[model samples]
Target: MITDPQGTILALFLAFCRMGGCVMMLPGFGSGRLPPQIRLFAAVAISMGVLPVLWDLIYPKASAPGATYIALIFTETLIGIVYGLIARLYTLGMQFAGTILAMSIGFTAPGGHDVVEDATENALTNLLTLTGLLLLFMMDFHHVVLRALVESYAATPVGAVIDSQKMLITLTDTLRASTMIMLRLASPFLIYGLMFNVAIGLVNKLAPQIPIFFISTPFLIMGGLFLMYLSIAALVRQYADGFAPIFTSF
Candidate 1:
């Protein structure tokens, strides 16, 4: 059963190269808050678990003489990074949308500790990002990603030629799709802010002597907060729903 210990170990490492690349860039797994040891172990475990299913595909390639094996390592790692970035870009897009929403509604609170990342984020943005991530986890989005990883072997085999153009196109398409979705989600607040500001401007023009700027600040923040409160549920719901279609499309 263990006749080919060397080959098996090599194959497992090759698998790890790919899976680890993905985990290195994958959102939750790669988050700065999670320990490196945990991510490393998770990648190793996933590679080992999937090895049997992919043995036929990986074992032979892992046997390549020195130069080829090294090349295969790079190729596999790049492919995995591409797959991970597809999902990463989508989440980053949501964060972008959140920032826009925050600005539109006048929630300019100072950046604080991010719930997910080690960096700073506005309170409103942090709320949106955390809530959206929680919803995605509750709906099992990671399962979808894991399924995609398994299916990717067929789409991109162990030693296949890495197509830079195709990968670039895939990333470009993901961004385009994600941008459109985020823009759609954030548009309502954008419009609301524009209209509110325009009306306020007109009022200012009519009553130039009044301290309109100071007076309108409170109203702007209050209105934005109220609107966000009313729509937060729907916003996060739509964000979680959009992930599958965008990810699966490419």
Candidate 2:
């Protein structure tokens, strides 16, 4: 049995790298505004917690650091990234739903505060996204996230090469399913918005002298906001229900 302190440290560092990569992209803690130092600190905490469990499984020899051991670190990091990306895909559901809702409510404009971290998204969309994230936290969804992380170790082991084709297929299926779900969630709003717009357009067309467009704007906004409030509870419940099954497959 290999018993070098240097090897142990190296092994730990490598394991930490994989864990850190995953934490960097994980939800809640991986928010764009979070400070890097804080993210790193969280990663460290997670690595420590996971180390004892993984050390024996990953660090077979404590002797000299061999080439295979070094390669395993890269594999572990890749596996971590894949796992994290799979979890992160769920956040897209919010984006999908929010975009549809905003479009239906006529708020999908090129508004300010349209950027979050590295991506461009309007304020309304961002608001809904933030709401979804906050709901996840309020519900202690992080526990579910942690459970998924632990489950990944069994589903997709460390030092194992990922099946890229399979992952791609899964990703595509996730995006499609999420978008469809969002469309379904926003269907009521979409129908309402469409009917309202058509009616308002007809009024404008019939009476060219009236300022129907300006008058209808506030009514539309008020109606949409009310509908959103009405739907909020059901929306949250649906998200929670849908999210639980996602981890089971991964």
Candidate 3:
């Protein structure tokens, strides 16, 4: 039953190019905390699993040997990166929202190591980002992303020339949509911070000798923490819910 070993291997590698590219930038799987070996093996395993399902669609195109095959490799990898970035942008938006939330609420504690990346981040921002990502994992976001990758082959068939313009548009749209959602999530904090700071400023102007601004720091942090306690569950739940529509629509 076996024949064309070379073709099969070639097809598998092609499949790997896409799946690996996607995994390289996927949210939970792509976190810097994860060792590269683990990610590599995970990608390899996923590619192996997917290759069988896509063998018919991919093998024919893959069997051809020439400069065209090299082009195909680049095209497939680009498509995968595009798909991964769609999900990545949403998660990055959460980080952005967290940073804004921290700054607004005066919760800018000394930066600690980020749970997901190499950079240092404020404690509150780290908490928010970690909680949001964990919730997404609990909700099985990876399954949705994998399913999307499979569906992508249908929307953008194997060996189709990459559409640079469309790819750019899709990425831009993702950034726009994610930013709007993150801003909405962080809006309450933004408003609260603005009003609180304004009141503090007014008091400072009225009673210039009291050192009111310095005095308010503890209260600001306490109130912000209390507000976060009251609303964080809903914030994360909404963040998780927002992902499905964005990923599925694209």
- Who is ahead in lDDT, 1 or 3? 3
- lDDT sort, best first: 3, 1, 2
Evaluate model 2: give its TM-score: 0.85
lDDT of 1 at 128: 88
The local distance difference test score of each candidate is 0.90, 0.73, 0.91
Q: Best-fitting candidate, measured by lDDT?
A: 3
Clash count for candidate 2 is 2
Model 1, global lDDT: 0.90
RMSD, one per candidate, in order: 1.0, 2.9, 0.9
Per-residue lDDT of model 3, residues 161-228, tens digit only = 67799999989999999999999999999999999999999998998999886799999888888888
Error of 3 at 57 (Å): 0.8
The collision pairs in model 2 are 2-62, 2-63
Which regions in candidate 3 have their CA more than 4 angstroms from the true location? none
